[model samples]
Target: MIKNIMQKVMALACSFIFSTGLAFASTQTAVTAQLVKSEADGTVLICQYRTMKKIHFKVLFTHQVCPLAIQVGH
Candidate 1:
């Protein structure tokens, strides 16, 4: 009975550690994109970039779109 309890406690501790590690690993990041145009009616848009995530350093690249910037926190 004591051994079983100890095993269960160890398992719980390991699980908690693993979960915390994952939670901390997946941090957060801010991404932004802008359109450089010359004309008003219709213009050519250029230059697009996404900021790297703080923890994972993940970046998503795309062209001109509705969501020019996005911020995700884990």
Candidate 2:
């Protein structure tokens, strides 16, 4: 029937669109922004260490919040 053919055509078109979108998305590259160090830091080593510690603390806090948030969420 005409309806059946149209349904198949629409489904094929949707699949093609989704496939192309995913392909384009995967081809995109990730961009990372580096932070600029201030003069007070004195050296690059100290600046890197400070940034590492801050990142560590943030990750720890985020992990710790997950459990408490899950309990409250439920």
| Candidate 1 Cα misplacement greater than 4 A, ranges | 26-74
Q: Which stretches of candidate 2 lie over 4 Å from their true place?
A: 26-74
| Cα deviation of 32, candidate 1, in Å | 22
Instruction: Report the Cα lDDT for residue 23, model 2.
Output: 63
Candidate 1's TM-score reads 0.36
Tens-digit lDDT string for candidate 1 (1-74): 99999999999999999999765663353234332222222343333333442322222233333334445443
How do the predictions measure up, each by TM-score? 0.36, 0.35
Q: What is the lDDT of residue 41 in candidate 1?
A: 27
Q: Which pairs clash in the backbone of model 1? A: none
